[model samples]
Target: MSIQDFFIFNCLEEKDLPLLHRWFQEPHVKKWWPVPKEKEDFFDSYLKRIHSTEISLYFVSYGNIPIGFLQAYPVDRSKETWLPKLPKNTIGIDQFIGEIDFVGKGYGTSFIKKFIDQLLAENNEMTVILDPDPRNKAAIRCYEKVGFVRVGIFPRKGDLALLMRYN
Candidate 1:
């Protein structure tokens, strides 16, 4: 069941840092999302103290209750280094259901559907992508339900990931 039947992507702000920090510490999140421990380091994990223009961060909420975090970024063709060549208009996503109580209750798929729908509505031709740890079956399943197609495995963040692109 969904919580309050609402899925919103609230613009992230400094005020949400504490909540964000707490989410990073959740065991479920820690299992897949290896993030910094300390608040300062954790903030850094968000990149340039959340000032990066490359990504858009959001607080996913069910009704008025914050349930998770989601971030989207465009692959910068100019800033080359690693990363397999992707579509020039590709948009990558990273997200987690922060509220432990909300895990595995179908909300992840619901939120993702709404979020991706919005992104496509904005730019239907824009390619959306996500790379989940090869072992994160739950996440992979959720993503698949939302229309992501398997694109093979690749090294990502010190581990192999099943890079999937929206199709």
Candidate 2:
């Protein structure tokens, strides 16, 4: 399905809390990024992070259903615990489909493309970065299909990820 038909990009808001927690706890997402967070803690942290000028969080909605989360950030300014270093002024994405049933459906790829399209519309000259685990072949292929080129590998904190970019 086309992005305009299946998905909507929106700023994360208070009313989205329940869905956010559900997304956080999904087995698919938790398998990759585990956290033992209570609902309030998660909400507070999400709010605090998104309020920073260097980051923007978007809730990925598919026909009014909260299906995933996406974030764009200036890599140089992030105090996030695990992000890799990138060239100054470059932005990167962190995204996932929290619904297990949606896995392998190619929705994540569409989300990346549509979100970047919207971002580039706002700033046509933006450079975008992505780092997916070297083992996630599907993700790597999908990113390449969306025009991001693999640049190099960066191993951070025992995890090795393939860094890719679109300029």
Candidate 3:
């Protein structure tokens, strides 16, 4: 389905923490997004990090149902010291379908493309990027469907990921 027909991006809020935490605990989400090892302090750390960072966290809703979480950040504002050289207006994104029921559907590609449309509309010259685990074939294909090309592989915390970019 087309994005306008269903998908909506909503900025995250404190009230969504419990829902976010529950999603993170799901096997599908936990496999990809391993939050703090200390589950007891996950919310504490998450709140501090989200509030203090220069990133935007959003929930992807499909037909009024929240099904996923997405986060975007400017590469230059990142705390990572090993980030490769990126364009001046590069925006990086990471996302996952938090709701298991939504997995394998066409929502991911459509939602991401729509989000990119919004970003590019705001700044047509800006670049969009993402790093997905090399083994994540599904994610790689979804990104490719959205017009992002694989730049190269990059090491992130001892794990290798493919750096995909869209201009």
Candidate 4:
């Protein structure tokens, strides 16, 4: 099936926390997202911030089956020192395909492109940014396919990342 046919995006709800917690424990996801060792602590923290005005989080579905998570926030709202250097209206994005079966299937590129398109439509002046691990060659390539150009490499939370932008 085509990517568009399978993908659906919905606002994340409090009821979804358990599933998200499970996804966080997955080896593939844990490698990038430093989810807290204690599930309750992680859930509490996420619940507190999920409703922030500066952030938006969504659940990614494929033909009604939830398969991933995506989130976006104003770059300036980030605690990372380097993010404020981006344009004023820039939005930073973070996402992961939670379902193991969905990896390497080209779904990420399709869903990310659609999500960015939606974000831009909602706020015409906004610029989108992403910082993926430099070692994740597949993710970097997917971002490139969706028009994100690597601006530089930078440190985030003590780890190196490839800073990419789409305007």
| Per-model TM values vs. the true structure | 0.90, 0.83, 0.91, 0.92
lDDT of 4 by residue, 42-152 (tens): 889789867777788899998899999999987775567865376788888999999999988888888999899888989889989999999988788889998999899
**Candidate 1: stretches off by over 4 Å:** 1-5, 44-49, 77-82
Per-residue CA lDDT of candidate 3, range 1-167, in tens?
Answer: 44556888998877787888899989978877779767658888767657967889898999889999999988874576567777788899999988989888878988899899999989998999998888888888989988999899877888887899984
**Candidate 2 at 97: error in angstroms?**
0.9
Q: Could you report the Cα RMSD, in angstroms, for every candidate shown?
A: 2.3, 2.8, 1.8, 1.8
Worst 10-residue lDDT window, candidate 4 = 77-86
Off by over 4 Å in 2: 37-40, 77-87
- On lDDT, the leading prediction is 4
Which 10-residue window in model 2 sums to the lowest lDDT?
Answer: 77-86
Predicted candidate 1 versus true structure: per-residue lDDT over 1-167, tens digit per residue: 44435898998887798899899898999899878768788776664646778789999999888999999988775663346788789998999999999999989998998899899999999999888888999999999998999999877546687889998
List clashing residue pairs in candidate 1.
none
Q: Which lDDT value does model 2 have at 129?
A: 89
lDDT of 4 at 40: 85
Using lDDT, rank the candidates from best to worst: 4, 1, 3, 2
Candidate 4 Cα deviation (angstroms), residue 158: 2.1
Model 3 ranges off by over 4 Å = 1-4
What's the TM for model 1?
A: 0.90
Candidate lDDT scores, in order, read 0.86, 0.78, 0.85, 0.87
**Top candidate (TM-score):** 4
